[model samples]
Target: MADKRDYYEILELGKNASEDEIKKAYRKLARQYHPDVNKAADAETKFKEVKEAYDVLSDSGKRATYDQYGHVDPNQGFGGGGAGDFSGGFGDIFDMFFGGGGGRRDPNAPQRGNDLQYTMTIEFKEAIFGKETEITIPRTESCDTCHGSGAKPGTKPETCSVCKGSGQQEVVQNTPFGRMVNRRACTNCSGSGRIIKDKCGTCHGAGKVKRQRKINVRIPAGVDEGAQIRLSGEGEAGQRGGPAGDLYIVIRVKSHEFFEREGDDIYCEVPLTFAQAALGDEIEIPTLTEKVKLKIPAGTQTGTYFRLKGKGVPRLRGYGQGDQHVKVTVVTPTNLTEDQKELLRQFAGVAGESTSEHHESIFEKMKRAFRGD
Candidate 1:
């Protein structure tokens, strides 16, 4: 096996990262390296690494084992006794619940359609304020001619001869211990328990046809990125006359040019000149909907955060809203004019860095005032 990187390092997280932190990091990394979204040459490799790390770290037991050993042999882990043993775990569980080798599936029974996932990218504002929009999706629909029966209008399906309408094929495997009997879906009948004698010309006996459909979707307000909404009976048609599957709309919110979000709270950095930092001023700042006036306090330091209550993104389901944090960054003058340079030098001489016999430090004076001393 190849030498594996630490799960924590792979996720770009510290060893003391919390579950929520791990999940958040994994999601961000997963989105960056997902093969469907990212087309970089190393994207697939990076995605696999992210997935493996999440798998180990997300589980407490696995995380404990990994933390102790640094490298746990996957094959030797609990329940990973052997490939064959683990493979049949689900089968054994099913047998335990429903009894072994009995209650065979009736292929003609109603089977729910396969669920479909559609990833949609929406604007950041649109995500904040829900929008009702139309979407065109191509999905499998029951054939009009055959009505999902997969047979001609006049002729019906015939019984499958291979499995005698049971829709299953039995396989006997001889192992060193004993005989392993397995029942698999019949290839001849395709698990339907029947075969169409005369196939429908429109669907060619598949019982379904691919067609484009228009659907209206209502996105609720305050939905964040990676949120999902399920639409019932919107996916591919089920086999025969069964119910249709659901369509899951996975959201991807487009990033705003100026804003970065954490939870419902939004953050933006505003640059301030030395004069603006020293002298209080009223500045216009952008919010999700409108521009608002932000009051800058005198002597504002770099990286000072001001919170505008109820000015951020709306809560997903609950009432009220989050706050917008404006981080003030003091920018130094880039170029100096002759007069401006001379004035600044004079100002610096007057406002010396340290307190002297003739001058008292402004910082110490402010501190004394705050302490009421």
Candidate 2:
């Protein structure tokens, strides 16, 4: 028990996390660590840890007990209540939802197909304006020849004589409390309750085939990175004529070379010459759509930000657009000619050491600071 990890920490949630938050975290982590999806060695272990945490936190009674005393003995209950009163653990809960424990399941029952996920990377501008494209995916589909029956064409499936079509077998176990009967899938029929004498050639008796499918996807305007788009009935083929599952597309937005976005606002830096910073000029600035003229004020300091309204990214929510911020950096003149140097020296002599109130320079401020003024 001392080596066990905290439930909240396992789910990456706080102690006061809501039920919805706990469930959401569980679903995300489960998908990330599912054995079918992730082939890593530790994926199954991580998935089990996530499932155990969710099992305890999902039940109110169990959650309260865990909150009070962390990681109690599995065979014992709180204050010696005994294991029988503990109400099933993770296996029981999983069985209840996935059709494994308690009652017998029909082998021919419809089971939903497994959901699928695809990650797509788009340009940063594409995220701002959005685009529509087609994607190819490999997925499983029901066999056309057997019509999802797993039997050969023109033939039908026969019921399993072992379990009497119940698809389950009863195992009686004697415990300290009493005798318990547990239901398990029939070994003869493999839980299908039907036997295929002549298997389908196309599907190899599996009742499904793999094929490449092309799907069209539409990305909405102003979609950010890590956003998801869902496509209904686009996952793997279901079993026993069940409905197909959905497909999830996760977005990955590529970085832009010129612009950096925060929320809807855009930021960029532009270089200005010393003459342009001192005498102010109308310079051309690049926007998302086209070039726009920006007026730099006289005596503008380096790192001064200028905002261009409605020049940033479009809003994903209600209305309008965001502003673009431009930071100007003054570039000093270099490799000056003798004539230009003499002219600057004469201009500096006339300017003297005095600094103007409205047009203060960083050098003047530093000098005044050194003099303790």
Candidate 3:
């Protein structure tokens, strides 16, 4: 057999590296040397080497055994004449750190799936009132033929010989202190303890395929632009029986022509004639629901606000509705006719020295200011 290589040298990790650091290194190297992506002449062999290094460094018990033995074969009998076996009790440790390796795989195992994001535009009114919409997303789904197992029907997986079904390998080293031991996951099985001899023809052993799927989502009321709604278990399906991720729907609300909304309140500008401001009158004002008559008090000034109670948008999660605020702007008539000017001159003569209750009150203030009081 070829000379056995040092695990730390294979993984390029320090002897004192933590478990988390070892895992991080493994993930980085695995992604780089995975057979599906890397096609170099020795990429597969390098990948297996990295995996083996990680298997030893990630386990505590196996690392302890290897530390005491310095390449002393673990299969050799210990003390007595019985066959030496260091593989026992490793299953519990594996299960504690990396879950179990039972024939029935776990559905929550981490796996990569295409991330999906959807942009949906809605009318302002529709966003406030809420609506149901259907969307079609093109993505990868679990393979139907293999049922996410990546194995052909009637064929079962075989134990990984490299790790002897322990999902890891032990390595012993002679150091200055004495001997050091380490245990790393088997590169051949990716810590799965088994490998598929025959892959599903449909998925090519990936257990997933690319396709488009349609899903319906219900948007709640009071949603705003840039708001995100998460649809759980609706994203692309995971590979190898892993659980699916989530889908995010980003909301974009169109601008409104008549009203602007702030939180639950609605605002609008209304124009009022000079006559309406000078003389108290009941004028129809537009609201979200319908037009309502509002009384404009005599001597009403421009930029005055009139509130219509409970006329704005409904609260999304609360009990009460918001109020509608109407801002009034006075519009003065321009380009009077000659007849109207003459009539206004005649009327001015009669109205010159006389002040009504509303006009007198304002004129008194001006007079006082002129006197510098």
Candidate 4:
């Protein structure tokens, strides 16, 4: 007892420190020395010591005992609560940590199940529209062999003599706080207030079994990569007779060979022959649904843009659809024959080679505007 470090020294606070000050010091030290956050060799031991210090100092009754006697007895309820301070009302904290294990939880309560997530990869076109998918997930279900009671078939579970089927036990201790009542879950019956003398051969003793279940998921339109679709009540079965949780389907859209997307808009590059660009041509272009004829204007140059309204992805949340923007690239004829070269040379000699006099490029337009032409 004498070899133990003073609780105040462990928290780096003085004996005259207030309750709030002690709480702040303890929280800071707890966060700094917590085993999960700090990987030092002594972190876990330091965390336990810090928790012990906070447990005593946070309680007015235990702190008084420690101040006078220099040590608070563990068996006398010194470090029972710091994190477990249920002074306001026991209902909130009691339900959280113990899941209402203290003489409260009904044997047939409907506890909520766990939430699950599954990643799915889909085609680019399917994301632009939508797709119906079925996935399989592993879940925990109540054992059919024992009917969730963990007892063998044809034999009922015996009543627990420890808690007398009430699932609770009263613990009375005398400390500086006077006589205190601390009720806990019965250990022998595991707070169920029932003893399974005969276990199910299939399940051994566990009341649940792991099962693979198939679930249907609906992927909405315009759902991008990393989008999540939630299916309610599709997760693991809850403990006892609880309700099922939600299942989240995370989307992974595959890359498209022809198109790229940004927010609501779609962009694509299409190649056009120089003659088809110069003289207007009705070209076949691919849309989400079908190939359509796109009319290219006469004298259309490279980098010309065309818009197909409502031809891209459908809106995921709003009223209308997005437009597809196509950039035209006029491909020059490659590997020209001698006759083709001679024809081009003769045509260039007669024609005005300047783009401003012919079909003006974007750069030429910009220069003309800048020079006030």
Candidate 5:
């Protein structure tokens, strides 16, 4: 007993650790060192040590006794009562680690159907305005011929003789601590609780059939890319009179050639000729719905952004529309006649000392305008 390590040290917990903390630490260490999961030679030995520590620390009475007397032989009644006082602890620990040993589940109970997801790609404009379309999907549904009974036309299924409709059986084992009872699905009826003598030809005793179903989905207005629309009770059919699951339509919007969207706002770049940018002009800009005229202010520099209020996409959740932002890019002429070049040279000579100075002046003005100075 003196050679045994302290329970708190085995769990890597302080003496003042709470019960929840102790359980969490034990579960972590147990999973890490469990022989089935960990292949190391010492894993099984470590797992046993962790289990022993947990068995002593997890119980309030055992913990108090161990805290006062340290490790003592169970045959000597640790403190007062015999080892038989701790009967159901190991069963609970087994259920906690292995799962499905807690209690029996009803095989005939209604279970919600599995949810389904479908990805659909739509045009960019369709995402902003929303659209309704029908799509076909393959899914399993209750057998129409047998009405989900898995039996022949006139015959019904019989209760499983092995499990007696409970759908599970108990396996008793004698462990080192005591006898442990574990519950498992019955092998006779394969946990369905019923045996079909004459199976339905259509579903082959499965009680379900696969079919292509067409369903109409309504995409809400202003739904963006990667958005999802859910249709209630439109997925795969449920079993044993259960409610059907939901169908989720995942939206994938195709990229637009002219516009980019951010949240509800729209953004697009428009090219302006040097003359049009210098002298100002009203040019037609294309939006999601129609073309609108945007006035270019004289001396509008490249990369300058202009906001058009209430011209972007409509808000999906609330009232009012987002503003459209237009970025200006001044386009320099590549092809110029000798006479035109001479004329531009004469204009530049009269305008400033160098073109660099003019660019500096324009850049300064752009900075001031951005700052609202």
Candidate 6:
């Protein structure tokens, strides 16, 4: 019989190697001495020896037992009961580290459900004022027949035989340093450690199915585009008994026609007639609220602005409201009748003298310029 070497010494690690370090060392060694890759006479036996070392050292309980007794024998308390007994706690550790030892499966663990995202477009007005809207999204939901178990209603899953319920497979490797061991997830059971003998017909053994669902969402006022709203527990159903994921509703607001928004303020251009610009008048202007009258002061010039207090969109977070800025654009008359032309001519003759302060100031400056002062 080959000498029974200390498991830790075979893997070139200390007795207190961390789980990550042990797993890393095992992967490196197993790849080197794998029988498929190495054809030497003692390659197979060396591989098995490396596997046995890793199988014990990778597990805390098994390592503790080996540490106390100097050997892990089936006769030892809670040991795997000799080689290939498949009852040792090492199997569970192997499954966890290697994904699933190529083995049998366990059936009773809860799995998390898949998450879903839905895009929703809302009108600008609706987004600013808040509205309740309905949305439809395609997603995977839990199967009603199997209750997300993937197994038939009355049936249960069985442990995988390949990994012997350990969910991992052991392999040996040879490296420049020496021989080593490796552990990997079982190919047969994946990493779950269980398999469904009879799959659920409703979900076709997937535990979930694609379906269109209708959800009602209440978009709060002042919500901007690209804002995401999360609805908890509304995504795909979890496998086995795991909790469901959340549904993320991404919002997209449409652009408005006449009004442009900046933060909480609303901006718009209001055209003013020549009469309104020259002879100040109070004119009705459109706002988010009903039309409000704005006073145009005498001698108001084009491009002048008027503000309506509390007439803009409501602030999204803070108190109070933004003011509506109305940019006045003076519109000159185009078509003139013969009578209108004659009247304008008479008015121009009467207005020959400078009456406005600006024109008077310009005339005085010109006189000084001519006098060289």
Please list the Cα RMSD from the true structure of every candidate, rounded to 1 decimal place.
16.8, 11.8, 11.9, 8.3, 5.3, 11.2
The alpha-carbon deviation from the true structure for residue 19 of candidate 3, after best TM-score superposition, in angstroms, is: 23
lDDT of 5 by residue, 34-91 (tens): 7667899998668767877887788988888788778775546443222333333333
Candidate 5 segments whose C-alpha is farther than 4 A from its true place? 1-101, 353-373
Candidate 1 per-residue C-alpha lDDT over 1-373 given as tens digits, one digit per residue, 9 for 90 to 100? 2466777999999988999999999878876776556789998677657766887889998888878776655545632212232223223324433445536668888777888888888998898889999999999999999998889999999989999898978776654323445667899988879988899999999889999999999999899989999999999898867899999999999998899989889999999887899998899998988999999989897779999999988898899999999998876665678898667657867866543547654444545654658
Where does candidate 3 clash, by residue pair?
Answer: 55-183, 55-184, 55-185, 56-183, 56-184, 66-181, 67-180, 67-181, 76-84, 77-84
lDDT of 3 by residue, 1-373 (tens): 1365766667677777788887888877876776545789887567656755665567786666545763454654221213323332223333433545423233234575556799999998887778998999887788888887778877766778897676776666543223434465668888767788899999887678888789999998777778899998888887555668789999998988888888888898888776788787898988776789999999887778999888877787887778899998776556879986566556655767433434543335544653657
Which residue window of length 10 is worst by lDDT in model 6?
80-89
Q: Decide which is better by TM-score, 5 or 6.
A: 5
* Whole-model lDDT per candidate: 0.80, 0.81, 0.71, 0.76, 0.81, 0.73
Best by TM-score: 5
Sorted by TM-score, highest first, which candidate order results?
5, 2, 4, 1, 6, 3
Q: In candidate 1, what residue range of length 10 has the lowest lDDT sum? A: 78-87
lDDT by residue for model 6 (234-329), tens: 898787778989999898888888887777778898887766877889988888868887889988866787887787776778877788888987
4 against 5, candidate with superior lDDT: 5
Query: RMSD in Å for candidate 2, one decimal?
Result: 11.8
Work out candidate 4's RMSD over C-alphas: 8.3
Clashes of each: 0, 0, 10, 0, 0, 24
Instruction: Write one digit per residue (lDDT tens) for candidate 2, span 277-297.
Output: 889999999999999999999
Segments of candidate 3 deviating more than 4 angstroms = 1-116, 164-186, 190-194, 239-242, 332-373
Deviation of model 3 at 198, angstroms: 2.3
> Which tens-of-lDDT digit does each residue in 1-373 have in candidate 4?
5677889999999999999999889768876776556799998567667867887888898888888877656455564333333231323223433344433665445578889898899999889989888888898877889877777998878888988886777776553323445567788887887888899887776777889998887888899989998888888767667777888888999999999998778899999886798788999888777787899998997778999998888889997889988998876567889997677656655675543346764345545653658
lDDT (Cα, 0-100) at 309 in candidate 5: 91
- Clash pairs of candidate 2? none
Give, for candidate 5, the lowest lDDT window spanning 10 residues: 79-88
Considering lDDT, which of the candidate structures 4 and 6 is the better prediction for this target?
Answer: 4
TM-score for all predictions?
Answer: 0.64, 0.67, 0.57, 0.66, 0.81, 0.63
